[model samples]
Target: MSHFPMDIIESLRSISRQTGLPIWLVGGTVRDWLLGRPAKDIDLIVPERAFEVGQHIADQLNGTYIPLFETVETARIVLRESKMIIDISNFRQKMLEADLFARDLTINAMALPLNGPFEPAQLIDPTNGHADLSRRQIRAVSKAALQADPVRILRAIRFTAMLGFHLEPQTQQWIAAEANRLIYPAMERITEEFFIILQHDKAHQYVDVMDKLGLVRVLLPECDRLRNIEQNNYHHTDVWAHTRLALAELEAILLSIDDLFPTHGEAVRHVLKQPMASTRCISDMLKFTMLLHDVGKATTQSKDADGIIHFYQHEKVGAHQSRAITKRFRLSNTETKFVQNVIRSHLRPLGLLAERDHLSRRAYHRYFRDTEKDGVVILLHALADISATRGKSNWQTRRQNLIDLIRQMLDYYYQPQPNPPLLNGTDLINAGVPPGAEIGRLLRQLAEEYAAGTITSREEALAFVKQAISPDATTTPHSDI
Candidate 1:
């Protein structure tokens, strides 16, 4: 609601009357208005010269113009006061009726004339979109509509999740008949619609729907290979099924954050909302990473003498295998690195938390020190991974222990050391110490000692450093150092 500019409609109509160019509010704007939902963005269509018209309207309203002049002759305006976006474009097929028929969905084909008074009678419904809206269904404008743009198939899926609408049986059959058309569009276009689906609240459920609709096979063929791959005794389902359940559990964990992590829930939630790439936030990445965490287990499966299964270093192998997937998706360097790190360290939390009774201050320090900002994400994935393992193990006890481990780790992560860092590389070099890895080693050691409450002041830290680098002292720390 904050993004809608309430006073701009008159200005737009005034400009339209003066210029004699009929601008109609089309697509989602009109649909949301008719549905009694607050509009976040606006879409308009003109007879022609959309780029120029869009810029002229922006200038008249003191808004900023974002040129989207492409094959469709589109441009955008960001209202300075409300910060809402308006996308204006030329009619797709040169006439309003043709344009409406060319659209993908009936619900989106309606347009209201901006030049006339606002009224329901002024609405243009070519494909009986109003009837479809009343029925809460998504029906294609025509079969050729999808044949014109296969990417709209993804939009149909997104609409079902976002608007809580169902695709009619005929539309579903059309989608099934040509599901492979999804692969023809540019990857960027496919990703645009794909991410909208992924960002929904029920993404876990709809993603499986996408798989069943035969779209996932065209996008991620590797997923089909995960089917029926068996796992160790700790898992009740096969690899693909467990992966889906893990994704579901991750969403459940996020929803139940207050119960699972009462004190640090909000802070952890805030971190998960950060943007990892242009289209994906940290939460999206977390869900996606869970889907690929055990990809290496298929190649690493082995049976010991006791007939027990083992997947030695599958995390490492999975990490190595994840690059190709990231590259195929054209993920940015930051997102690619994040996915790799999560797969590489997905098994760390349990191993580190297994010794909670004798857990060293150095262990806590080293784990967070090594992971830094990624620790939160890694720990959340660990919980989901273990939560999905509903097999022959002591499930309830392990679940409690994992949750407690997450609480302790998050506490250590949020609670800073009582004292500031005592020594820097410059100070170490000034003290005749070498300027290299040893300085880093000494600083890490000091951080651990500070965590342990053994080193407090600058004087004590300097003496420890002096003793650490001395010829006779046999000083060692955690392996991570």
Candidate 2:
């Protein structure tokens, strides 16, 4: 009642009163309301004739009606230009139980009346959702619900991460049995949930559950390979443990940086604090990249004679695997390329350093060309990835190098593109220079030299080009010529 937007409540009540149909603001909106969190989207339950009610609400509010399952009984109401969603559903006493039962956990099943009398909106304790919510326990409504939709198994992990709740024992068993069914869900759906976990502060807790329930094997079977995969002497944990720790550290780093720079976290932290959510700022494609970033280690891991393990050419191998995975997931071209770029250029820390022998100007250009604005993400991933390695590598030195590289790149990227061809080919042609391959090459060379501060004026550029075309004149000084 506290967190529910008064306007949404009044709108629902107006609809229910006008239609003579009972509607209740149920599900997450109510749960979040009780938790003192902001609830903008609405999910309403109608005892009977939900489709008619849905059509009426959309009409009355001038909203859009979207049939969720191509069924008139289940529809969504979208407020015009507001991005507010009101899911309307027909109440099937058994199916309502089934729907509530099918939800990943019990705490999300509580409901409140929309247009009924002044009495308190009934808690509707059919599944003991209130008790579970009070206990902060995520208990499944029924096993049949998990059978109906196996994706709920994966979603349970997300709820645990977001709410800091523990999965009930029986629900935990259900998840263990059906975790592999996650592969049956759409890749996009799996990736959607992945980000929610990454954004949450307690993301590692749910990831641990995912690992234990065998869901990691189904969604990212590559993770299973990392289990018991020991690292070299410098490491403190195995690959799977390291991966989860890395992700958790990434979240912490993002959080700490936000405290240091609030506006930076504005886009990412919103979904992190939500009970049920998806990523908004980081694209779904990038989430996939994060999910698969370490996958190649499963293939490239090796043990040397000295008992030291090395993942040789992991980045190169990862790049190939990422492309295949992207295609298998039916990703868009831009998304596929983005994932590929992340995987390929993930090992960019040393290259970002100012070491003259290691980093050429051409290499510097290539880094910007590939990473573009995602340089931040790449750098973040590098920091997280290396830290996860559990090696003796000095993070401070690495961090300083990264900071220097970022400052340099930002300085270059933000400035105007080197004064926009101070001497164009037209200028070259007008300077008694014949139009030919030499002219194009000479003009390009002159612009590069001018950009590097070798020449300042058009006269200097013209004089330089003349000297190039007449090197013989260096020996014979002809003032007239």
Candidate 2 TM-score, true structure as reference = 0.78
Candidate with the greatest TM-score versus the true structure = 1
Name every residue pair that clashes in candidate 2.
Answer: none
- The TM-score of predicted model 1 comes to 0.91
Clashing pairs in 1: none
User: What CA root-mean-square deviation does each model show from the true structure?
Assistant: 2.7, 6.4
Cα lDDT for residue 128, model 2?
86
Per-residue lDDT for 1-481 in model 2, tens only? 5545778678778877886777777788777876767876888887667777888889888799887753437889898966688898876464555556556567777677766652334666568887787799888877877777776776777887778888899889988887767767677777666666755655666777778888778766666777787777656788778778777666656656565334445533443333322233443344446667777788888988987789888877878887777676565676666677777778775455536335433444456655765665676666666656556666656555565564454444344664666678787777767888978777756755554455777778778877776647453322210
TM-score of each model, paired residue for residue: 0.91, 0.78
State model 1's lDDT. 0.84
Residue-by-residue lDDT tens digits, candidate 1, 1-481: 3434446766888888898888998988878877877788889898888989998999998899998768989999999988878899998786899999989899999998888888778989989888898999999887788988999888888888889988789988888787999878888788778778878876888888788888877887766677888887889998889988998899899888888999999999999999988778989878778878988887888889998888899899989988888877777889889999999988888888677787866677878777767888899999988899989659878988999988987887888555446888898998778988888887877888888768888999899888887889886544531
Candidate 1: 10-residue stretch with minimal lDDT:
1-10
